[model samples]
Target: MSEHNEGDLFRQFVGDVKPLKQTVRGDKRPAAKDTPGLIERRRAAQELGNKEGNYLARQEHISPVKPWDLLSFKRDGVQHGVFRSLKQGKYVIDATIDLHGRTVQQARQEVFHFLRECVERDIRCATITHGKGQHRDPPALLKSCVNHWLQQMDEVLAFHSARPQQGGSGSTNVLLRKSQAQKDKNSEKFNRKTSRK
Candidate 1:
């Protein structure tokens, strides 16, 4: 082949390759800014979380209880017999919340919400299973927290560690105050008299 013909063939092969104008780091489009509606929605959600978190004390410190210890409480005016029933796990548990794998913050929020909902639904008896917490540094961390927090809630009329069959020291039996509707229903039941002719 003549030198000119060979050069023409090389040019034809190389013609498509061009020098890069700039090195591309990546997709360089401007960062997307959050929309105003999305920002407002996030803010509202955060506020709701804060409000709910306030219901239970998250940082308050109390002396830790032993993992094997039993937890019990009874507000004034709660009859001894009723408290005994609760201690004996005699009342049918209407609901239960298990905090076995939850962090302290999670357990706090769950306990507060659970008790509130139970009261609203007229749940007279409930169980809270806060694992022994034996592996934690403070020991019985969740159990101790549950013990203190339940004392603060007015809705909790009484509480006691569960029986062996229930959950032993790892769980608690709670007696909640009656809702207004429940109170009215009970009153009606007691006040109504049957008339037979």
Candidate 2:
């Protein structure tokens, strides 16, 4: 065949040839021990995970903002001295978040996440501006929501509306729980000081 016909002739020759069947080489190795039991266990675990995900989805919405007494809320714990300190504006706030015009939902998430970050950084004090809401019927919706959400977190040790220059009715100053690491460090320092004396 001429060079031009050589390509078509090659294609025809190849097409006429029977194709080889592919054989999947099965493993000659021993069967995996407890294969059926393992598969069953994996299936059960996945089902349980899906069930738990659905259950958790239903239980979401920030785990419900528990009934909190805003009037008596500032005084709600064992740290009378600490609460007094917060009320008295003794703690130097290291971080501050301004929630001036944010919606209640925005404020709640910001306050929660902000407090967690403060705790992680070992920051003891923070201030949140939750708008006094002078125009609103009741007043200070963000303030009240911040108060509720703050109490819900395990990190918040104490919080009180700030002194006038610090936003007064419009903001709150917070104290975070001392992490175990800080507590241990403090105890070690105290023990050393006492031993020296």
**Highest-lDDT candidate:** 1
TM-score (all chains, Cα) for each model: 0.70, 0.57
Clashes of 2: 0
- Displacement of residue 145 (Cα, Å) in model 2 is 0.9
**Candidate 2: stretches off by over 4 Å:** 1-77, 137-139, 191-197
- Could you list the CA RMSD of all candidates, in the order they appear? 15.1, 19.0
What are the Cα lDDT values of the candidates? 0.85, 0.67
lDDT of 1 by residue, 114-137 (tens): 788899998999999997988888
- lDDT of candidate 2? 0.67
